[model samples]
Target chain A: MRGRGKKYWLEEIIFIGPAVLFFSLIVLIPFFIGMTYSFTTWNGVNDEITFVGFSNFLSIFKDEGFIDSFCFTAKFTVVSVTLSNIIGLSLAILLTRRLKISKPLRTVFFIPNVISGLLLGFIWQFIFTKGFGAIGSLTQIPFFKLSWLGTESTAFWALIIVTLWQTSGYLMVIYISGIINVPTELKEAAQIDGANHRQYFRHIMIPMIMPSVTVCLFLAISWAFKMFDLNYSLTKGGPYNSTKSIALDIYIEAFQINRYGTGAAKAFIFFVVVALITFIQVRITKRKEVEA
Target chain B: MIRILKNHRRIALEIVALLLALICLSPFYFVIVNSFKSYKEILIDPASLPVKWILDNYINTWKELRFPAVFANSLIITICSNLGIIIISSMAAYRLLRVKTKLNKAIFGIFVMAMVIPFQSIMIPLVRVMSSLNLNTSNIGLIICYFGFGVSFPVFLYHGFMKSIPISIEEAAIVDGCTSLGVFFKMVMPLLKPMTATVIILNTLWIWNDFLLPSLMLHSRELYTIPLAMNGFFAKYTKQWDLALAGLVLSIAPMIILFLSLQKNIINGIVSGSVKG
Candidate 1:
């Protein structure tokens, strides 16, 4: 037993020590330190700082653009998450069907996901600004001539469209796995019991894929909340700061405006809001899973 | 017969899928075709292929973006970071699996928890820590940062998958007079090839394409990764659409080639990782 104890301790040092050290130094310690900085005024360049308590948070609460960014992020999250899941699941269903060319089809659809979001955004920017401009001229459509990332309403929708286009293929991959894993016999029995396609979909498919739905929804929400590359590349928060999501706002505060403490505050608030929403979602979904 | 209608339905679905493909492919069309056009021509007729078939943009962009150095920097960073992550995370996971004590459980908890906390909350503090350590701007420092940030999730993946591996394999090696290290390197490590592939692919793709971390860590122009270099091009030449598009395409070419080549493995890794989690 003494020898076994020695062996275990030695193994622990060899295996787990580096990881714990790295994670502590890089992630855990920094996280708490950044949280502390949110309560202080640190411009990231100068060393002088004083703890001002909740004033940063209070100021953020009062800032109109901060509020607008928050609302835009929330709306973006909802719209993108819903559409991404719906489109993804539909594609997943189609791809998982017993078709000969499903393999190549899935590959083609998922190609965009492998590319960087920044590039994807840039590509879509070109498409909207140039290709759509040509189409607008040829067709003489008034709406197409208007700037995509310049207007508030159109900018918000443009962000959503770009996000959905890039991400749905990814979520579709996830849902395809989910759909394929559903008990085939259960689905077969439902089909055999004189149920039509719609009935089978409503009764068997949705419930069976609920776990995947939960996962995809959670991922989409997190992604949309933290979305930056696309927003940065396509709009850079726009002609009048219309497309600024919370992440972009935090980025501008830190990198552009050099307001590290304010960015930290915004990040902290963003964390709290996301954590609350995700926690609530998990509880609800877990309960549903248990009951089902 | 119902067979004819089924054929019609299939054809209709194929058409719809084709339209979707056109939509997906048009962006690439814009980037590639526009890269060859003169700026005035691009502005005048952005949808068409280049009228002049100009190679000047590629030549000019290659020069202006400092292609050779930045590409080397990106490759070096991605490779070093991936290597560090694979080494440290694998060792850590191996130990966690072997040592099933209370400490290990707590460590596991920490790793799983790290998966959910958004990077934004921690990024500023991470930068602060790097600065305090005097590690900012050095490639080594950036490598350390990448390893530090990347180790948690890969370790989590390795730990979970390693649990399913039977203990008897390691025990057999030990009974054959192998030391723990020997047994790990000779027997246990090779068996983890699949998970290793998954880790390598996922981490490589991320580290290769990462923008924010490199942007923050590397103020020195010499250390600029692809994304950072690409963005630099954007900032430097805002109105030079031809050169910018050319650089953008060049920046993403490595990843694009990688995706096309190992697409099967990548898709497998993503699906397995996501579903298992």
Candidate 2:
């Protein structure tokens, strides 16, 4: 072979030794530890632990707020992913056209993303509370001016609008890159075949940018699932605890209520759900990419 | 006639794009313009550009928010965390790519596995580890934690892009009596500039904007990062909208300026990073 196999083994050990140890200590070890803790009733602070197997997972089904949060997170993910792709892809197409102002427009659109999620939530909180009031008074629209984030129904939509506002620009940049990479020859060929704009987009453009769509959906779903700061800043899961996401629920369980076992169980459940969805998504999308 | 119709469609798209852009930017405009107005004026006329410009809110909020102190804290945390991340990630990436053996492959697999394991999965034990090590509630401890967490993705980014890089250069350098470390630093590091830029931009924005980790690990007031510091103003009773908005504007301004300067790279970085990662 290339050299003595033992030498190669030694070299490999020398090289990968640190990364393995680091990841184990930092990531893998902690993950398993968290899984173990899920089976125990370890009140986050005290070291006293009682072994309770599967009861934590069992309790999740009975927890009404957990169910609501799961449903809310799912609904949020679907709507956010769909809207983000549509708006983002549309903006990407428009901005990549032969327009002079597209450059500045792209920058303006992306400004909110540079700021922290907490900051965006706070900023939108201001607009929803104060700025929405102003728009309502000026335009005299009833729902437009109402306390958008006060009630459950309105608070959810308010969160949706703000999330879209903050994130669509980032996704747009991604779509822009994907669109730009589509072969010009293929596009021109479609044009020559007498395909109209809608037909070309439906057939050629959509399939070609399927990779970007996968990536966008993956990000949008995970972000929606992990969404906490916005809910925290805007409503603090308030006005009868309407906007509580899983991440927020975990935080509340851990910090607010100090229920470590329940929080750990909740967190484990969160991980499993997100992991399953993401695994399926990546597999399906990767398969599509390979097929295409 | 066909050309005219195409032109009309293009114009319509442009108008729609412009309206969407306005919707995207209006809130930002509101935040900036209202930061200069008095609280009473803002409450009375939130939409209007300040009728009489007043700098007092900015001045007062600047001091009350402890802008300079918190700015220093954020700078220290970001700089240290970023440096730690770059070092650990680059070394790990170099080692993973260069050393091709069963053990290395297994280690690399472990690193990839780290990518999907959400932070929520590990936070409970992580906190326990931190407190046990007396690493909680301090800036240094937080930076180390960030390094361990942040390195996985950057390493992945570097590893993927590194595959496309030819090994002959490194071989030649080794033949020239360069050590592995020297070869990586002298040859591979320079070649990795684009990916480095991507990593830097992504991680900088992440570190600067991160709230939850800092809020959890850091309990001390003086060590509070910008996000946590702004959150200090938000109480269960009596939320300060004016001060909060003003603080938000202040915290976002530096990064906005930075982002504006590096707009093209930011776009490229995000695209390549996510696409590859």
Candidate 3:
């Protein structure tokens, strides 16, 4: 009995040791150290750290860049989540129909997801500046000629547009799986009751696919909140910094400007905000999900 | 007559969906077409096909960007990171699932909870941590950083899949006097192949496309990955659209080709990954 227990102990250490070790070394320790740094005004280098309790946190209220960036991230999250979900669900509905082109269309839609958001931002930058310029000239359409990335509102919409283009397909893939798993019996029963197309869709289809809705909405909300790469490369958080995401704001604070203490505090706040938001979203959607 | 009308409606919807796909692909069209055109020609009519196809842009960018070196760097980082994450997380997940003790449960909870800790949050002190450990410059350092950040999701994925696997076979294998590690590698590991594909595909997409972690860890020119290289290229040559677009093509070509080859598995992996939870 003792020997068998000893063998089990050895196996446990060998199996689980590396994961817990790396997890603590990389994530756990840095997190605690970051919490410590958030108190002191440590300037990332030159370790002469002065402790100023909550002063960095206090300053965040007056730091207009961080405040604006938070608000911008919040607003961007709301709009992109709503828009992407709508477009993605629509595409899923369209493609799941008995269409000849569903397969190719799915491929086309998902192509945007394969490339890095950084590269896509660059690709779209060219299309907006050069391609839009030429198309505007050829067609003489004022819509294409407007300086897309020059102003505040258009730049906001530009971020929103690229985001929709990038994520809607990924979401569509999830929604399609959701739609496919809806039992056919439910559809037949709805048809037998003579439910109109819209009525059937509203009452039966939506309820049957509530699980997909849960996952899709959860995915969309979290993605919209964590958006950094696309926002970074697309606008560079420019046109008066109106498009700066919270992630970008944290990066700029720590790395670019050398305010390690303030960056750490800001990151802690960002973490809390993200956790709270995703928590609420998942709770809400989880309630709506109906088991198949 | 009613059936014919329904068929017509389906065909019309297909056409509308195809048109939308084309609209979705317009940026790709503009980027690919403009890439092959001369600077003057691009400005003349970006919508038009190149009057004189230009090979110089691709050739110049290939040499100037040091395409092979950056490509190798990205491939190494992604491959190494995925391998580490898979092995470490799978082993932990396997044990954590088999042993139903309170301590193991708490550790599993910690791993799962860390999913919400975005990379940007801990990245400040993570840099400090890596620098202190003297891991800031090498590909190995960046790969380790990925292991830390990337392990949580795969562990969660594997834990979920491990629940579906029966324990009877392993117990029987044990009765045959197969050693513990022998049963794990010989029996359990082979059964893990389907979920293994999911872990590999999803993690490959993520670690390959990640820009920020590598951007933080890698400082030297020789260590730059594709995203980092592209970022530097754009900063230096923002005005040189011809070479810039060609460079973009070079950067994204590998992932696109990989997608084309394994799209069935790619799409299948995503579906199972999402639905598994």
Candidate 4:
């Protein structure tokens, strides 16, 4: 018994030690250290660290830029989440109907997702600036002529359109798997009951694919909230910081502005909000999944 | 007559799909076309085809960005980080499940919860941690950071996958005088190929395109990844549309080719990875 126990211990250290060590050093320790830094006045370079009370948190609330960016992020999360899921699910339904072109079309939508968001930002910048310019001239369409990244409103919609273009394909794949797995008998039975396509969709299809809804919504919400690279490379939260996301805002405060303490505090708050929102989202979706 | 009606509907569906696909592909078209145009031509006739095709843009951008060096950096970082994540997560998952101890369960739960912590939250202090460890500057250091951030999801995936494998196989191997490590490698690793593929695809897609972590970690010009190098170029030459378009094309060429080749596996992997999670 003693020999077996010793062998088990040795194997445990050998198998699991590296994961724990690296995880702690990289994630766990930094997380706890960040929490402590939130209470101190550390400028990220100095060896001297002075502990302050909740002043950093207090100041973050007063920082209008932080508040503005938070609101912007929340708005982005709602719009992107709702629209992406709707469009994605719709595409899934359409493509799953045995359309001959569905396979290649799926590739078209997903192509944006494989490329880096950073690069996509640059590519779309040209589209908005030059491509739109060219199209506007040839067609004389007022819509294409609008300054996409110049104003707050158009810029907001431009980001939304780009995001939808990038992610709907990804969401479509998940929804496709869900729609494909809905047993054929269920659809046949619904039809036999004299249900029309819309009725069958509303009652049977939506409920059946509720799992996909949950997954897609969770992913969309998180991605929208944490959006940085696209926002950075495209607009850079431009037109007087009208489109700054919380992640970008924190990055600017901490790294660019060199306010490690305040940045850490803001990061902590960002963590709380993300945790709360995702937790609530999962809870609500899990309930729907059970009923379905 | 009914068959004709159904055929009409299918044809209509095909047309609508083709149109949408065209709109989806328009950006790539503009990018590819303009990449071959001269700077003066790009400015004068931004919408029209180039009067003369030129290779100067690609050649110039290639030298300016040091494409080969940056491409190698991205490749090394992605491959090494993926290997690290897989080994760490798979071994840890195996141990945690096999032992079934309270400590192991708690450890697994902790890792899962860490997935929810936004990178923004820990990133500031992570710099401090890395600097203190004397590992903030090198490719090896960046790969180490990837292990911490990237393993949580893969570990979760592996945990779910490893649950289905009958433990009796491992016990039988042990009884037959096989070492534990040997059992894991020879018996268990082969069974994990599907999940391994999923892990590799997702991590490679992520780490290769990620601009933030590399931006923070690698400040030296020689250490720049493709995205980082392109960002530097744009920051310097925002108006050089001719060269910029070429750089964009060169940077994304590998991903486009990768997608064209392995898109089926990638789509399947994404579906399984997300659904199971």
Among these predictions, the greatest DockQ belongs to: 4
* Tens digits of per-residue lDDT for model 3, A148-179: 99999989998898999999998899889888
| CA displacement after TM-score superposition, residue B3 of candidate 1 (Å) | 1.4
lDDT of 4 by residue, A70-157 (tens): 9999999899999999889988888888998899899888899999999999999999999999999999999999999999999998
Candidate 1 colliding pairs: none
What is the lDDT, from 0 to 100, of the residue B73 in candidate 4? Answer: 94
Q: Write the per-residue lDDT of candidate 2 for residues B12-107, one digit (tens) a residue.
A: 877887887898889988998888887788878989998888777778778887899998999999998887677667777888887765656776
Candidate 1, position A88, lDDT = 92
Q: Per-residue lDDT tens digits of candidate 4, residues B62-164? A: 9999999999999999999998999989999889888887778999999899899999999999999998988987988999999989888888999999999
Worst 10 residues of 1 chain A by lDDT: A283-292
In the range B190-220, model 3's lDDT, one tens digit per residue, is: 8888998999999998889989988999999
lDDT (10s digit) by residue, model 2, range A184-260? 98899998999998998988888888898889888888888889888888778777877788888888887789878
Best by lDDT: 4
lDDT of each: 0.83, 0.83, 0.89, 0.92
lDDT of 1 by residue, B91-197 (tens): 88888777766777788888877777777888888888998899995988889988888998888888888888899978987898998888888887898889988
Residue A240 lDDT in candidate 2? 83
Q: Which stretches of model 2 miss by more than 4 angstroms?
A: A1-18, A290-292, B1-8
